[model samples]
Target: MDDYEAIRSGILETFERAVDAAGRDGAEATRRSLAEARDILAADRLRPVVLGEFKAGKSSLLNALLDDTGEPPLLPEAEEIATSVAASVSYGDQETIEILRDTDDGTPGLRVDRRGLREHGTEHGNPENRRGVLSVHIRTPSPLLRPGLTLVDTPGLGGPYLGHNAATLAALPGADAVMLVLDSSQPVLRSHLETVRRAASAVSATDTPGALFFVLTKTDLGGYGEVLADTRAKLAGALGRPAAEITVVPVSARAHRDFLAHGDEEDRAAGNLAGLTDALWAALCHRGVPRVLGGALDSLDRGVRALLAPLEGQTEALEDGTRRTVGELRRRALEHQARLAELRKGRAQRRVALRRRIDTVQEELRRDAEERHARIWDRFESHYLEEDAYLTDPQRLVAQLTADAAQVVGEINARAGTATAAVLVRTAAETGLAMGSSRPTEMAAPTSGDLVVRGRLGEKHRSGRLKRRLRDLSFGGSMGTTTGALIGSVVPGLGTAVGAAVGGLVGMAAGWASAGRDLRNEDRRLDRSSLRTQLQPLKRRQAAHISASVKDICEEFREQAEQEMEERIEQEREANQRLVAALKDTEDLTTATAGTRLAELRERTRPLQELRTRTAELEARTQAFTAAAVDRTAGGGAAGARKPEPVTVPGAAGDISWAEDRT
Candidate 1:
C-alpha cells in the first residue's frame, strides 16, 4: 500500500479503538470528536474541476480522460450547451447515477437511470434548470477515480443561461485544481481572460500553487499551434506570470476516443491524453495531495487532544487522595461558579474594547483611503496636464487612468485589511485565544466591461495651445473607482460605485472634445475647463463608497474575532461546569460509595491508557506520512527512500505496566 493508504488505515483503526473505548467508558465528548475526525477523513478527496466556456469540450475531455467507452458515454455531450447542473464523477463499485435535487422540502438525492441524466443535466432538456437540480453524482469503477480523485464537470461560463455561469463559479472554491479548457479555434475573449483570472484567484485563495492548468482542446480539427501560443500568452498576462510558468496541454478528446477503439499508436500520440494525465498527477502529488493530507493530520491531532483532555482529568481526580466533606466540595463548586461569572464579565468588557479598537481602525482606514486618493488624483492631474499624448489619444488616456485607479484601490484595500488583521491578532492575544489564519476578502480587478467610454474623439493632433492653457489652469483632483477593489480589499455593494465612478471619468474624458470634434477648435476651449466641475460629483461618490467599504471590512473582522473569543470562553465555561458536576456527584457519595467510585475509576484506567497509546501512535504515523509526502512532493527525496512500518493496535486486555498502578 502507498504511504497515504497505509497512514489512513492506521488512523481509521485508531479512531475505531477510540470510539470503542469512549463508548465503554461513557466519554461522549471524546466519541463526538472521533466521529468528526471520521467525517473529515471520509470527505477528503482530491477534486479537480473542469471549467470552460460553453462548447469548449469539457465533458468530452472528462470522458476521454476517464476512458469511458461503454455503449453510452458516462458524461453526455451535445452540439449545444449540454451540462446544466454540475456533475461529479468518482469511484464506486458499480456504475450508478444519483440525481441530487433541491426541492421545496429539503435537498435529496434520487438514483436515476443513465438515460435520465440528459433530462436533468442538459440545457435543452432542463431549460435554465427549472427542475432545480443542484448537482448530479456519477460513480464508476474507473482507474482514474480510484485514487480518491473526483473529477467535476461544471456548466460552462459566459453562456446564455446565467445559472450556468453561477454554477461554474460556485464549483471553483471546492476544487483542488482547475483545468481551464479553452477552444483551440476560438480567440480568447475578455470574458475568457476574466474566467482565467477568477480561477487563478480561487486556487491562490486555497493556497494551492501550480494547481491551475490550461487545456486547449480541438487539436484534431486543424492547426492550432498559433492559437495555443496566443492563448498561453494571454493567460500568462492575465495571471501576471511568465508564459513559461503556465502549463498548457493541447489534446483532442475525439482522437483519444478513436484511439481507444482502434488501438492506433499515432492516434494515441496525437491525442496527448497520457501527457495531460501525467501533468494532472504531478500537480496532485505536489500540491493537492500534500494539502489534503496536512488538513487530515491537523484534524486528527485535534481529535486526539480532545480525547486526551478527559483522560487527563480523570487521572488527576483519581490521583487526588484528599478526603473532603460535602461542604468542602460545595465550597469548591462555588469558587468555580465565581470564576465562570468573572469570565463572562471579562468577555463583555473585552467586546466593548474590541469595538473601540475596530472603530479606531476603521477611522484610520478612512483617513488612509482619503490620503491615497489625494495622491492618485494628483497623479491623474499631472498625467492629463503634462502629457500631450493624452490630449490626442482618448483611449490611451482612459486606459492609463483606469490602471492608476485600480492600483490605488488595491493599495488602500491592502492597508485596510492589514489594519483589521492586526486588530484581530491583538484581541486574540489579549484574550488568550487561539486564532486561525485570517483570510481577507479580495476584490477582483476591473474588467473592460466595467469601464465604458462614450463618444468618439477626433484624429491625433498636437495642440500646443491646449497644453499651455491646461498647464496654466489650476486642476482640481478627485478620486475614481475601479470595477473591483484591489487584491486584498473590496467588499460587496461597491461594484456599481466602482463602475460608475471609474466609467464616468472615462466617459467624461472621451466625450470632452465631442464626437469627431477637433481639439484645436476654439469653440471647445472651455470644455477642458468643465472637466473639474464634472469630476467633483464622481470623486465625492467614489470617496464615500470606498470609506463605507473600509468600515464594513473592519466591522467584519471585528465580529469574526469577537465570535471566536466568545466561543473559546464558552468552551472553557462548559468544561468547568462538567468538572463541578463531577465533584458534586462525588460529594454525595458515602465512604463505601466513594470506595466503589474509586474502583470504577481504576477499572477505566486500562482502557484510557490503551486509547492514549493508540492515539499517540496514530499521530506519530500521520506525522511521518505527512513528512514523507511533503519531501516527495518537494523533490527532496525519492518515494522509496523509506518504508512505513506496520501499525499494530494493542488489545484492550493488554498489559498496561507503563500506566501508573492505582489498584
Candidate 2:
C-alpha cells in the first residue's frame, strides 16, 4: 500500500467511477457517481489480482493452499478448455466474453447449456477439447479467501486453447504476484522465452516492479534437472539478472492422493513437489497477493479522498441552498394559503379578496424576480468582463460555440470568459469580408474521434463513440457537453449565481447593440437567468460568447478532458453536499476522538459486509476453475519431469503420492 500503488489504484477507481457515471441516465447520475467516488476515497475496496498462464499449475497450487486449512475447494470432475491462453480470473461477471470454443476438443470453458444441474444426473464431466473462452463470473468462494487476496487463473502459453497468445502474454507482467511455470522435463525453447520476455516488459515500477517465480512442473519426468537449467537461463536472460534472481522449484501434483494416504511425500517425486510448493510460498510472503491487493485498496482510498475533499467545505453551502429553497417555497405556499383562508372567512368579499390576493402574489413574483435580476445583472453581463475579454479578443467567445467555417475541428469546452472566440471569417477574397481569414471561427470537432491515453490496459483508444458525443455538442446540438448539463438548470437572468457573471455583460452589450436605439423602450432582457424562464437574449449572448470561437481552442482540451474533467469536478464539487455534511458532522472523518472514529468507520463500512459475503462465495467457486491433472513436462524441456501418467497406471492417480510441478 505504498504511495505509487495507491496512485495507480486511485486512477483505476476513477475510471470505474466515470464508467458508472457514463451509464447513468442524466447528469444527476453523474453527480451521484462523483459523490460515490468521493466517499470511496476514504474507504478503499479493491483486490489486486495475481494471474498467469494456465497449466502453470495455478489450480493445483491453490488447491494445496486450500487443503492446508480445514476447508478445501471441490475441484470439478469435468474438464474443459485445453489450456487457458487468455487472461483468466476466478471472478468477474461483467464485460462478458465467450469462452473460445475448442476446435480440437468438444470440451472447453464452462457450460450452461444444460437446462439444470441434474441434466447430467450425477456425472459432471467437462466437454472435450475445449478451446477459447472459459466463463464470466464476479467471484468464487474458496475458504482461503480474504479481502487482501485476489487470485487469478489464466490461459496457457500457446495460442489455441483459449485464444490469442498475445492477450495472455500481455496480461502477465501487470501482475503484482507472478509465477512462471516451467516444464521440468522440457528445456526452455527459443519461442517460449521470447513470450516470457514480452510479458516482463509490461511491468514498470518507480522503485521495482513485480517479482518472478519459477515453478518446474512434472518433476517425476526424466528431464527435471536439465530443463531447470534451461528455464533458469532463459529467465535470467529476460530479466537481465543471474539465476538467483528467480525462484525455481520442482513439483509433481498427482501425488495429492498419495500424500493424503501417507500424510507425506516420502518418494523422491513427491518430495520434490512438496519442497517446491513450500519454497514458492515462502518467497511469496513479501510480495504476496495480500500486499498487492492492499496496495490497490490504498490507491482507491486516496482517489476517493481527493475527490471528496472539496465537498467537505461545500456541504454547508449546499445544505444552506437546500434549506433556503425549501423554506422559501414553504413560506410562500403558507402565505398563499393564509390569504385563501381569509377570503374563505369573508364570504361577502370572497371573490374580490381572492382576486386581490392572487394579484398581489403574482406581482410579488414578478417584482422579486425582476429585482433579483437587476442586482445580478452586472455579474452576468458585466461590462468589465465583456470589455476585458473583447480587448483580450472578440473572437474567443464564438470559437467555443460553433463550427469554424474553413477548418472543421474546434475546441468544445469554453472557459470563464465563455467560449473561446471563433473568428467566423470569410476569405477577404470570397466574401470581401475584412476578417483575417475565411475560416469559420468555430471549427467542427471530432464527435467521438479520440480522447485516448494509455492507462492501465496499455491499449490505445481511437474509437468514435466519444468523439461523436463532443461533435454533437459542438455542431449538431446545444448543451451536450458536461459543461452544458451543469448549466441547464440555470436561471438565465440569475447568472451571477452560477459560475462567473462576467460573460453576461458582454451579451447584454451585444443584445443592446443588436436592438439599436429601440433599446430605450425595448424589453430589456438583462443578461441574467430567471426561474420560470424564457430564453433571454442575455443568456443566449453569453452562451454565444463562450462558443464564439472553436478553431483557436483546437482539440487540445478534448485530449485533456479526462484530466480537466477531474479537476473541474473537484473545483466545482460543491454541487451536492448532503452526504459531505454527514461526514463532517462526524468530525471530518477523523472522528472527534479515536474511539468514535473507529465506531464511525465500522458504521461506514457496514455496506462492506454484504460485499464481503458475496466475495467469499465467489472465492470458493474460483478455486475450482481448473483442478485436473496437468502435464507440466509436456511442453517443458527437462529430465526427470514425467509425462502425465494415466490414471490406470500401476502407480498413478490412485496410488502415486507424486507432488508434480505443472509449471
Candidate 3:
C-alpha cells in the first residue's frame, strides 16, 4: 500500500475503535462525533474537476490520460459537439455506468450501459438536457483512478448553452483540484480569463491552493510551442502569480494514442503524457490527500476530547468527598443562567456591529460602482459622439456600450462579494463562531432589452430643418447680390447675364453648404439623444443589479453568521443545563455511597482515557504523514507544507480547549 493508503487506513481504524468503545459504553454524544469523523474519511476522494471552453480538447485529454492502450476512448469526444452533463470517473472492479437525475421528481440513479452515456451526456443527444440528468457516473478499473481519485469531466464553459456553464460552475466546490484545459493553437480569450477568475473564487472558499493548474492540449498539430508559452504568461498574469510558478503542461492526445499503439519513442516524446500524469499525482499526494488527512485528524481529536471531557467531570465530582447540598446546586444553576444571559448580550452586540459594518461596506460599494459607471459612461459618450465609426453602425455601438456596462458591473459585484466575505470572516473570528464555507453568488450581466438602443440615425428634426432653411436663404441672397455687383464691375458688356448666372450659382452653393452643415449637426444631436434615452435605463438597471447582488451576499453572510452564533449559544446552553442536572444528581447521593460511585466512574472513564490517547497518537501520525508527503512531492513544485491550524471544538459539557500543540 502507498503512504496515503497506509495513513488513511490507520486513521480509519482509529475511528472504528473509538466508535466501538463509545457504543459499548452508551456514549451517544461520542458516537455521534465518531460518526461525523468516519463520514469525512469515507467521503474523501481527490476530485480534480476538468474545465475549459468548448472544443478545447478537455475530453480528449481525459481520454488519453485514462486510456493509453489504443482502446476506444473512455469519454465521448466529438469535434462538433460538447458535453451536456457532468461525468465523474472513479475506480471499480467492473465497468459501471449510472445516470443521476434530479431528485425533485423522486428519481433514483438509473444504471445503464455505455450507450446510455452518449444518449444522456452529450449535447447532440440530450439537447439541453431535456431528460433532467444531473450527472453521469462511470466506474472503471483504470490505474489512474486506483489512488482514490475521481476525475470529473464537466461541460465546457463559454458554450452556446447557458445551463452547461452553470453545471461546470456548480461542480467546482467539491473539487480537490481544477484542471483548466486550453487550446494550444488558439490565443486565450477574455472568456477563458473570466472563467478562470470565477473558478479561482470558487476554489478559494475551500482554502485550497496549488489545486488549480493549466493543460494545453492539441499539440499534435505542431508549431504551438510559442502559443503554449504565451498562454502560460497570460494566465499567470491574470492570476497574479509568477510566470514560473504557474503550471502549464502541453500534451497531444493523438500522439499519445499513436505512441500507445505503435510504441514509437518520437510519438511518446511528442505526447508528454507523463508530464501531465506526474502533475496530477503530485497534486493529489501533496495537496489533496494531506488536506483530507488533516481534516480527519482534526475531527477525530475534537470527538475524543468531547468524549473525555464529560468523563473527567464525572470522575472529579464522584471522587470529591464533599457532597453538595441542593442550595449550592441552585446557586451554581443561577450562575450558569447569568453566564448564558451575558453570552446572549455579547452575541447581540456583535451581530449589531456586524450589520453596521455590512451597511457601511454596502454604501461604499454603491458609491464605488456609481463612480466607475460615471467614468465608463463618459468614455462611451465620447466614443459615440466623436467617432463617426460607431455612429454609423448602431449595432457595434450598442455592443461596446453593453460590454462596458457589464465589465463595470462585474467588477463592482466582485468587490462587494469580497468585502462582504471579509466582514463575515472578521466577525466570525472575533466572536468565536464556527463559520462554514459558502459559495459566492455569481452576478449575471445585464442582457435585457432596456440596454438596447434602437433608433435610426439622420432622422430629420423640424427645428433643425427650419433653422437650416433660414440660414441658407440669408446666405444665398447676400452672396448672390455681392457676386452680381463684383461681376458687373469686372466686365462692361454682357455683365448682367454673366453676373446673374454667376450670382445664382454662388447662392446655390452657399445654400447647399448651409443645409449640409445643419443636417450633420442635427444627426449628431439625434444620436446623442438616442444614446441618452437608452443609457438612463441601462444605468438604472445596472445600479439595481449591483444593489440586489450586494444585498443577497450580505443576507447570505448574515444568515450564516447568525446560524453559527445560534448553534454555539445552544451548545453553551445545553452544557450549562447538563451541569445543573449533574449537580442536582450529586445532591441526592450520600458520602458513604460516593466511594462506590467514584470507583464506578473511574472504571467507566478508563476506556475513554485510552481512547483519547489513541486519538492523540493518530493525530500525530496523520500530521507526520502529511508533512512527509508534502516534502516528498515538494521537488515537483508543489506548495510547501504548512501546519494545520488548531480548531476549537465545542463540547456538550462546556468549551474544551484542544490545540494541535505540535512539538
Q: Top model by lDDT, which number? A: 3
The candidate that wins on TM-score is 3
- lDDT of candidate 1? 0.61
lDDT of 2 at 298: 28
Residues 1-663, model 3: lDDT tens digits? 155566677778878877786677555655765677687787778788898988898888888888635234567786535455678999888888899887676766988776667777777777767777877889988877876778998878665554465457656655677788999877899779977776665455445445666788998998887887788778877888766656677889989988878899999988888778766654454346645665566556555554554455555566654555444544766686676667687877877887798778767877876786677578776555676766665555655555555555555555655576567557656654433322345555554353445665344454567667767867886788677767866788847667866786778678878778878887777877876775676667766776676677666667666765665555445544555665566667788777776787788768767766776676566556544543443444322222333434332222322222121
Number of colliding residue pairs in model 1? 1
> What does each candidate score in C-alpha RMSD?
16.4, 33.1, 9.2
* Model 2, span 1-663: residue lDDT tens: 132233334444544654343334133433454454445433433222333343455445444533422222222112322232332334233222234343556555443322221121112233321222333222334333322234444445442232223234334433444556665645577546754554443232101222345566666555566667767777778767656445566666546545754676365346355454333333232233223232223223333333333333233323434445434444543454454345335534533433343334334333432342343334334442343332233222222111111111111221100121111111112221111111112222222112221111222233553454444334322222223334534747434334233334334444444444333222122211211032234334433333433323323322232232233333223322333333334333232353454454455334333323333332222212111111232223222222221111010001111121222
Off by over 4 Å in 2: 1-140, 148-150, 158-167, 204-209, 220-230, 260-262, 265-663
Over 4 Å off, model 1: 1-10, 22-27, 44-46, 78-80, 98-111, 128-134, 146-149, 158-163, 184-191, 206-209, 218-231, 250-252, 255-278, 281-296, 306-345, 350-663
Per-candidate TM-score against the hidden true structure: 0.55, 0.35, 0.61
Candidate 1, 1-663: lDDT as tens digits: 155556566666666776676566455654664566566666778888899988788878888999889755778775546554678889888999998888877657778766687777787667767887878999998877875788988877766554355456656655667789999979999879977976775565434446677788999988888888888889878988777656788899999999999999989988988777755654454345544554444434444444444334533554464544444544665675686577578877888998999799778877866886676568657546344454444344444444444444555554555466567657655654434223345433222234333223343344674664443231210212232233114555556656555554554454443432544554234333444444445456556666767766777777777775665455445444555666666656676776777677667556656656665665566445444443343342111112212222121112111111010
TM-score order of candidates, top first: 3, 1, 2
